[model samples]
Target: MKPKRLYYWLMLAVGISGIGGLTYWDFYQVRIAAVTRNQRWVKSVSELLHSEQASMARWIEKFSIESATFRDIANSRRDVAALILIDNRNRQAQRWVRPGLRLEPLDPRVSVLQLRALETQKTTMGPVLIIQAKPYFTVARPLGKNRALIVFLDAARAWGLLREEASLWHIRASIYDFEKNPMFSSFDPVIPAGALAQTLDRARSKETSGIVRLPRRLSWKWLITFHFDPASDWIFLITQHTTWAYAPVIFFVICMAGILLIARIPFMALVGTRREETAQALAQFAGRVDSYIRGRDAMLQDPPSGIKELFPIAATARWLIPQWKRAEAFPRDLALERKLLSLLVESLPEGILFFNAQGGVQLSNELGRVFLSLEQEGREARMVSGVQVPRGFLEPYLEPVFTGAQPNLGKEVDVAWADGKHLYRLWVERVEAEQDKTGGFIVVVRDITFRKQWDYVQEQVLSGITHDLRGPLSAVLGYLDLMKRQLGDGAAAKVLEYLRMAREAGVRLSQMVTDILDVVRFEQGKIDLVIEVIPVVDVFQRIKNTFGVIAEQKKVNLKLAVLGDSNMTASGDRKLLDRVLDNLVGNAVKFTPPEGSITVTVRSENGRVLFDVVDTGRGIPREAQSRIFDKFQQVRPGDRSAGYGLGLAVAKFIIEAHKGEIRVESEVGIGSRFAFWIPIRPPDHRAAGKSDALVNMDPNEVVFPPPAA
Candidate 1:
């Protein structure tokens, strides 16, 4: 055989051995899993069978006990018939019959046998019909009241299930008399005389059910017999077999075996063969090397007598030398490439810096050095324009590099800088390197002085225009107000009404200007809040009185209820909270139907004080609630009802400023409730008002009455 052919044969043998071993292992594992699942299924079936047995026992007991427990119904035969005792006299002691069927007389021989059996008091009886042809189990229980009640079970259906579905089990269940003679059996089998006598004696002696296993036709089958005393001398036998109960488990095991054969074995074989082939190849290569070395030494020891032998040794060495050389160069080549890339990265422009995870710079390029030179008083790089920057100048940026938290700007931050000649736009980004090394950012600083100048000019012009109109608007409103007060009646008053309308228009314009200013302040983080603890009752009273006159004119019932008024104070910005209350109450009045009610409530719950304004009005639609607190947003189309759509937005800001929360609840076509909470203890920036009770109401408006159950 060729050497290569011999080597392949050995490898095949090794692979086959491995495949055989793996097949055994896999088969064992699959078998174990199948057995476990089957065992679990069997256990579950056993438990279910046990539970059913107990239930049947209870059912039988309940049936037997009904004779005396419901004696009136038994006697009247309204829902049940009376209990009867068939004694040795061949006559019933008591009989309650339906119209058709009559009780049968007991034959003397049978009666004597039955009476003797009754003295033993076995749990099972036979040939007793619950309803004729429904030949069922009969349990005779002796009532403490001296009555014998018999209960018949319709177990024929259950037996049918066992036969049809539980085909796996071979069951032969029967009811036997206390004398050990079979009264009823599914298929009569010869019973061992000793076992039969023992079962009968057990039934007669035990107060509860008894169980046993029996061998029939040389097959080990389960004979589980349980009984309940339905009447004096009768017991019901409800027997089941293990195979019948766990038939599904058997089927599952068969299916699992098929699956393992079709899938698991092939996969295990493939894996084992590959592993064995690899191991055999490695072992063969080593063996060949050892042989070659020994051959070489032998030749050297005695001057290799032929040229052909030496040629083979030389050829093997030549092959091994090249493989060793290639293996040696692989790591060197990788190291050389990495070094080259590092050199190239050190020489880029545009502030080429790598950011660490904590937003600090780890490396920077030439342009980065130049930028840093301008930003910090003294900062430098290891290489500046291909030359080393001094240590003194590089020290400042090194702090961020070492800490890995701040980016070396390599440039000055010119944001809000007043210099006209220099405007630098700075960009910062974060990146992740391999092995958990975080690089902060590649910062680029581009000068945009000319563009910045244009932006500055635009902002100045806008601010100027907003500022210039305020004085003239104030004068217009003041003059219109004075004119309306003077001209109270007649045609001049009508002319003054038009002037008043113009003044109101001017006031709205002024408020819009203020909102624009507030927006600017908010964006700049310059908005300041004046917080205070205020009586919510007072705030509500002011709005109610102010709108009360308007409400009277419109004939709307404006009801106010300050429940728990003795504890109505809340800690917050008084003015801001007032604005929130005003906006909600105003919206309520605006949307309310004529003569509808607007109710304001103040109460305390948990730790916070709550203010609620409920309105029987045209409630807000579901779609509008989410956007109601946005600036310049209004639910009313076309900005109707004297609102600039800034009320809720402003209220939201003020409430948030006080660290309070607000929520609105409403259903379309139903009313709405706007509720908010204010903390009892004012925040760090204290405002001078106590979290205490408010003044009593005008009494004309709704007041808090004593609570009732």
Candidate 2:
């Protein structure tokens, strides 16, 4: 084998070993994570056991000869089902049975719960027993002088306590006796005693806590985390599916394996014997070909090669020199052209960087050098551009083009660099000399930090100006209304007509200001949704009442339809929904010409509420439907004065804030149908005002859900 083969084998082995190590480490971490998650509940149960043991010991000390002691025990300990006390002489007894339980007293001499504790004179907990459909167990300790105290504990209560903690951690918890008998479980059907013992048997013998797998016959192989508490003399087990622990790591392994295979394919091709064998055979036959072709003196005494199969190669080589020289011959001034090209590339304001097929920098302008921080300053273009682009700087932006996954210059990628002190917009153009073998990329970088900051400041300025206009606009409308009301029926016909015109102009201007302010807020994510339950039909009725007069003035037919339970309710910002409905219905009224028909439809479907506003006027053009909801977009761009072109955009924002979507389907000559859907039960969240009350996100950056498939 060649040295290359050995080297490749060693690389392959190393890659496989690394992959194996990564997979093993991931699994180990997953196991530890699972153990950690289970530890929380296990610790809780252990604490409960310790507290209960201590409480029982204290209760025995706190017990009194008074009649109130039984009542006190009942109130203090819900787990106590019964309490028995034998007098010092064993002849006298005082017993208290918890309400709702009955058990005949046995001779203290024959009572097994006390027998062992009496002999040892120590406190001990005994085996479990069933009483009146509830599990019970005993805590026994000897009093002075042949007397004993036995308290019957309600195991059901203990189980209930465990259930709460187990539910909190979303895992099943149980306790087993030293003999592996199941006593208490948070869920049912509880793990069988035999199964519990079998699972515990799989655990490491000396380990107090470890992960164990259940038998395949009993399950799809679930895993359990068992913890033995020596102080309580009980084994606690937290059970969860194995998928919980292994799924993420298993997925990671699969992804890593695919990447490794892709990386190794080229190496395998390079190390293959086919290319080497073909090269060696050609070399043996054409041994003298290079010396004979390059030197005129060497060909006079001997054959160009010793082998017989090289006449065609010998002819081609003899003719190759003149052809090669002719192909490179050019009449242009090469040095001057090079000087001009360098000057032109270096004079550009933007940065230009050239990268070869292997992702090594081939050349760059002085600006590109500065952009990449290769040097603080440079006057000349970099000729020996041997450095690589910073890792991850270009991969996200250019890898798709290199792999043919994306077309060249299809998208612009803007990235923040230097801890966000600077931002750059980058474009990549692929340069290919042929379909295969030769390719490179020309990356253009434009600094846009100042432009971005200017846009932000402009938005702030516009927002302030638009907001200030609202007050004056409101005052103008208020005075106009007051004047018209006071001058009612007394003003001349021409005067009334002029006043109406002024009021109409004021109303239109006021609406424009309001829309401008609203759009700014929505884009900046400053508008908070006032989420509440909304009556869908009621909102439709109000729109009908308001727009019915407008439709009448235009001689258009206005109608309303309630589908699928008119009483259906939706969860969202009631005011916002009203705004959305107003936009759709108002647009229908405005655009519908004389004698046209408009219908407002409301319905509930599949746990969501749907609204559709259909109009029979000149419909939205089909080509413009896609971006009808975009800011400042309109179907009739030629008619800019019709409105500010913000109604649909504002409507879309409101619907999206409710986690809903709005869309339009239109045919140019036919009518248009605008539809939107919002979930009937929106998720529980703070109102969209602030993180302290609503969402935690960069308020300046408005993030919308991806378009539906």
Q: Estimate each model's TM-score.
A: 0.32, 0.35
Where does model 2 exceed 4 Å of error? Answer: 1-455, 485-488, 553-555, 638-641, 683-709
Per-residue lDDT value at 64 in model 2:
62
The top-ranked prediction according to TM-score is 2
Position 638, candidate 1: lDDT = 85
Candidate 2 lDDT, tens digit per residue, 1-709?
7666666667666776776777778878988888876776677787885676567666665666345576686677777778787665647767888667877645242277676777888776665555665667677778754877778887776667778878877888777666665667776633556766665664325467776544566444566778876665567787776676666567667866776676677667875755686667676545665555456434522333433456665667667755664556543457668779888988887788887866667778987766555432433322223323343334445554554443343222345456666655566666777765436777777776787588568768878997888888889889888988889998898888988999999988877777877877776668866668888778877887889888898999988877768787889887778888888888888888898888877776656677778888788864476457756677888686447678898887777677666667666767888878877887443444212211121222222222121
lDDT of each: 0.54, 0.68
Off by over 4 Å in 1: 1-465, 481-491, 565-567, 636-639, 685-709
Model 2 TM-score? 0.35
Candidate of highest lDDT: 2
Error of 1 at 197 (Å): 53
- By summed lDDT, the worst window of 10 consecutive residues in model 1 runs over 690-699
